[model samples]
Target: MDPIAPESADEVFLTAEEYEAVHAAVRTVAGSRGAGQPQTLNSLFEQWDELVHEVEEGYGWSAPELSNDLGCRTALAHVWRLLPPRVRAIRQPELDEIDRRFHATTVGWPGRDDQEGQWWLRRVPRHLEAETSQRSTHGWPMGWDVMAFPKPEAVEIAD
Candidate 1:
């Protein structure tokens, strides 16, 4: 596919050199300070301000365009978003159901096999924590992986 002419209308129209130049420049100047995080143009730092100008003139693109679109600007903007006052939330309503089933079954079999013997087949709800830590890496936003378990007793018996 020719970068000078996008393969499809949905793609951004630019020359190959233009695309590579902008992306390369973004990577080059986005994190020059060695601060462990990408430097964002939104910051009021004098050096970053100067760097912004250099990027615009260097890439023939404006600062706002840099922020509004993908490329290194979008990545840096993502970093900025993640570096704010945001609390990560975890959904754990299933924990309550797990407790209920565990208690109900164990208590019902109190004298049978028995709760006193510490031996009872338990078939209750279990779920994994689905929480995402509010931290960005490589200018990417934070994310999470979820794992859910079905209630054992609720399993359908095969006919």
Candidate 2:
């Protein structure tokens, strides 16, 4: 089936060059400093912010017309999948802090059972959940893979 046919409204096809350009820019952001120590959560968070800009530039230069809704999702999934190994790694202490913040956020968050909560939950990274056996009883929602770097405000509150 052809991807760009009028009947395939939900599909957006990228040229091989476009796909490579977009993903390469994202990978560069993920590995800018080379690999060694695992990237800190805070550093990864900063890099993710930078990556957003890079993705925009990549799409702007490579395939502006193909940058539709589905294309955006594709780009995000690609970014998540291509995240550097160093960036995906998290240590025990940071994992503990993530658990603490997750629990704290649930308490008093009016939208805990609503879309906002779902959005927050969607960002929870697979590595974070994989480490769950080391701390708490629950794991992140199944199939989650993106890094959900915690908001500092959520963890700063005393419970």
Candidate 3:
């Protein structure tokens, strides 16, 4: 099978070194919840917080955007997708509670827009849903498996 080439120069493929670096950064940011321990909502929320902080840093900088970089985005998406079904199930209520608390305290604060207040709370869930939908529709994003060489489709020439 011939390897699949990037259709354009704009597409980013991680080299072996870059893949390892990104993988390590992701793991460092998305810390583990003890090997055998059951994941609680708090633990999951903590993980979400850490992941968001890492991805959303340098928000106004002119430097390369971490949120849009293929390797960083894919690595973060991979971590988000790894959350177990039970943890995913609890996400909405947790998010709702966060929104509730934010609004509860911020009520009557000057110029506080609901959308602005809720943006952080909603970001991860929105990203996860988009990634899940894309995966279902288009299969995994290209460069998802950075370590593996692309495989070409089999062809049969008709005589």
Predicted structure with the largest lDDT when compared to the true one = 3
Per-candidate Cα lDDT values, in order, are 0.30, 0.33, 0.34
- After TM-score superposition, the amount by which residue 64's alpha carbon in candidate 3 deviates from its true location, in angstroms, is 25
lDDT of 2 by residue, 63-123 (tens): 1222231233333334545544433232233433433443333323233452432233322
Model 3, 1-159: lDDT tens digits are: 111121355453445654444344435554444685433324444544444443333122111222242232233344445544333343445545544543332222123343652233222111111122222122322222221222111211111
Candidate 3: regions farther than 4 A off:
1-41, 44-86, 108-112, 116-159
- Per-model RMSD to reference: 23.9, 18.2, 21.8
Off by over 4 Å in 2: 1-41, 44-81, 85-87, 91-96, 105-159
Q: After superposition, how far is residue 150 of candidate 1 from its true place, in Å?
A: 59
Which of 2 and 3 is ahead in lDDT? 3
- Candidate 1 lDDT, 42-152, residue by residue in tens: 231234334333433332222233233223323443333333121101112222333344344322221244333222132111221112323233211122111122223
Whole-model lDDT for model 2 versus the true structure?
Answer: 0.33
Query: What range of 10 consecutive residues in model 2 has the weakest lDDT sum?
Result: 123-132
Q: For candidate 1, what is the TM-score?
A: 0.17
* C-alpha root-mean-square deviation, candidate 3: 21.8
Tell how far residue 28 is off in model 1, in angstroms. Answer: 17
